[model samples]
Target: MSGHSRLVELVPLYALDALDPSEAASLESHLEDCEACRAELDVHRNVAAQLVPDEPPAIHVWDRIEAAISQGDEGEVIDFGAERARRRGNPFNWMLATAAVVALVFAGVLVGQRLAFDGLSTDEGVVAAAESAAEEPGALVGDFLVDDVAVARVVLSKDGLGYVIPTDALDTLDPSRTYQLWVLTPDEVAISAGVLGADPGPATFTWKGDIAGFALTREVAGGVVSSAGDVVSVILDT
Candidate 1:
């Protein structure tokens, strides 16, 4: 046989480390001259490595393997004539068995998909879904991040007066640069509330103008004559 075929034939012995030193040396030297032998040897070696399990499994995997060697994966092979006769006797039953397996697999896939789909809609997910829904206006999901980092989601209430709500629990509101709620669109500026600087957790407040007109802004402790800071948050239209 050619060197490549010889390598294939020798592969099981090489994998088992049963090759004699002289034979192994000859094979290694041959590998340098025969590229096909080297390639085939590498493939066989990789297959051997994969046969070793990564960990001690919980179940007895070797039980079936032992049985498989004595009897083939399907069953003990019958004489071809006998096998033909048996197949002829039960062709309809074989088709039914195959169909049942296919139906079971299809049901399992559908159940798995439904479970994944149901899992997507969580309590936390509901708020995002509500906001994204086509009919409803965008909403303010309150700040849950950054401890001691104060956030005020100033929402303009429907009745026109603005509510200055603290997104997080605030520290002592800055006495000097008071947090004043300002209603500002592209045009006019109006003070919703002069900075209380001490309102705890989601406080409601009064508006200087119609909430429908301008977006909201926070200014110094005492309300500002002009815009000082950015529009912290805006109630987006539904």
Candidate 2:
């Protein structure tokens, strides 16, 4: 396979913050010249953002996010409740949703094994991350993948806080486009979770309502009234 093809497979995981140091370093170097991969990487990173476990701030997160974008901050959180509430609810067709869910579950199992193999308690960061997760009730965790390869993991708390833990697989995107996350409500209406980028690790955001699942799409840089890009991934809020 060509280098781009290989890197394409790794973009999702890289976005999830699941890539090891050496592998991640190599990918970052490749990204400097490969703008297509960089854009694809942004897609995966934004999709994976939904799986992170951190909590969003109380208010004006979007204000800060816009400021950060203007100031060239690496990453920033943005609110999506209002936009989500206003959008018409046409979620992905059932078959596609089911397929994505299956892939996500399969990837989650593999990622769990990888985490275990890495030695659990020895990594203080892992332990702390777990302890942090333990504080939330009805917390949901699962893997998201592209073609059965583990790319990212999603976590949501009973209170609606969320996090996306991505691995070493992801894809880059176009500079004129941005990735947007959507939360499907129990009523079947999809709500926006805000835009996403390539600055891996964890980001925090808030949503209101009974969430049924999540979706990702690429839209114009700032975002749009409705998602125009193809649905890339879906994970029903479980």
RMSD of each: 33.6, 13.1
For candidate 1, write residues 1-238 as lDDT tens digits: 8666766677567656679967765665566567766667678778888998898764566884565455533433212123333545432222222221110011222222211212122333432332232122331222211232324433333333333444433333322234544332222223244343533333445443332222334455554433333343333221
lDDT per residue (tens digit) for residues 112-225 in model 2: 233321212233454345335534446555555568765555666566667655455645543445666666666655556767664334344576556667776657777654
True-vs-predicted CA distance for residue 210, candidate 2, Å: 0.9
TM per model?
0.28, 0.50
Every candidate's lDDT: 0.39, 0.58
For all candidates, what are the clash counts? 4, 30
- lDDT at 142 for candidate 2? 56
Count clashing pairs, candidate 1: 4
Where model 2 places Cα greater than 4 Å from the true spot, the runs are 1-31, 34-99, 103-131, 198-201
